[model samples]
Target: MRIRRWSTVSVAAVMTVALAVVLWSSGAPQGGRVVGLGSVVPWGSADPRSPMAPPPVRGQAGPVVGGLSASSVGVLVVDGGRHQCSASVVASQSRRLLATAAHCVWLDGAWRVDGATFIPGYAAGEEPYGRWQVDTAYVPPAWTEANSPIEDVAADVDMAFVSVLPRDGVLPEQVLGAQGISFSTPPQVEVAALGYPALGSYDGQSLRGCVGTGAVEAFTRPESPKPSEIRSLDCDMTQGASGGPWLAGPDADSGRGQVVGVVSGGDDTHLVSPRFGPAAKQIYDAADTAALAATAPAPSPSTDPMSAQIAPRGGS
Candidate 1:
């Protein structure tokens, strides 16, 4: 199913004042540590607005379709400043790129151009392998404008890819590896969405999956900034699931699911994503190609090992 987008925590269609636009229309975290990386602790009441929290990963699906058990696994955490979101490695162009939402790493407020960390296959609060530093981040041109949430579109532009310096002497494949990405024109017969939501029905620590029937929604661009022709579904998930990929094709569990939509933002009850469409397809293809162009240091072509970027300031 397609995810929804509303600026900040509220999914309403109305355009609120900039100060009130703290969250993305996708209901993303306004401020916090980037995913996977530890969030900074506050000196006072712990900043109730914080989004990251250590919780257990969901295993009910037992690594089945949409289940949270596979090598394509990784984490996305907000920064302590609550301005950006960083993602772990699933797969990459020569293991150089890390995928996430555009809103997750753009300059918004004072948090603009802030640095983040990436830890692939992280477990139990520890970087089992090593810590990788984020280098440069890329976002869509549309997101760089002032219109913002009012220009929302669940297209590829919503996605962002970044380069990183993996732990010394390691290629991405040598480490945890990466997940395959797709741009198949939406409405895949069936698919699943996965993520590690630190709130809601999720336990925060473990990964969770949800099955949903996908179909493309068509019409014209809405007056709002949200996307059109999103692959709609009815899966119930909460915050922290933002930027999760809507995968199709085969993997550890479900087979033959290609990733089409990404968790963008949602309505009062559901999450929204930029549907896989011509626009999304173009962006992803470009990002992948761009990653391939990077002169990532190649390992001595060794095998067996594990591994691992972000920014974008706050909203309103």
Candidate 2:
């Protein structure tokens, strides 16, 4: 996704107009005061509406073949189902939290609050864990107020959390199993970036991933924009993959890992994510806090941890 392109929001598809246009479609918050440092590499943004839509990532990636990890990652249905982005279930006490890019849920100066659903373990038109509706989305105050020409997006506030309504009395975490997430990101970590690529020979049905060391990319514009630092890696996961997770200490088969960042945007060769920090922790806390406030009964003693509900794709 390019910063200059005014198409949709998948790393850089900026569609600020109608729903048809707010389409590189995607979803942010948490607490720790953010700190940033990175190499200044200028990569102009792209026009996603162009027939030559940019590749989702800058490097090679393949299907997340046969892993319970893919089960936690899902297609985020938004724009009244006219558009989609990738999201994931993350560990939360309430078992109802999802981690995704803020742009996926709130964009074009407003929240994409209508008809948001998360389909976990979705592949080839199959919903392995069924579908869950998103009841609430939380964006940091900085993100909602981040519209400025100098800074295309506020790096400090690009991530968001969504709280989904239960399905058949079961929360998403109870079924899909949540990935572990941390607001205190390390200086550098090897990670596997995962998502469902919608364009560029991708059907947007299955999970795909690219692995690399994530490094911070800082922006220092001539106009002296806000101090911004975002984690980036070489990935070709492109438009539909926004809001996907960057997992460190990832299991090759189970996909269990620590989430360090969320996909935000990327140039053709690299994907970007706002560094998770104290601000992010606060937003995450807000969502988690709300889940605790709900009236749902305590989970049964038999409740387990991080388990996918249904068989994986191509399974019997």
Q: Which one wins on lDDT?
A: 2
lDDT of 2 by residue, 6-37 (tens): 32222442311110112322221111111121
Which candidate's TM-score is highest? 2
> Where's the lowest-lDDT run of ten residues in candidate 2?
307-316
Runs of candidate 2 with Cα error greater than 4 angstroms are 1-58, 148-151, 220-226, 250-254, 295-316
TM-score of each predicted structure versus truth: 0.62, 0.73
Question: Lowest-lDDT window of 10 residues in candidate 1?
Answer: 16-25
lDDT of each: 0.43, 0.62
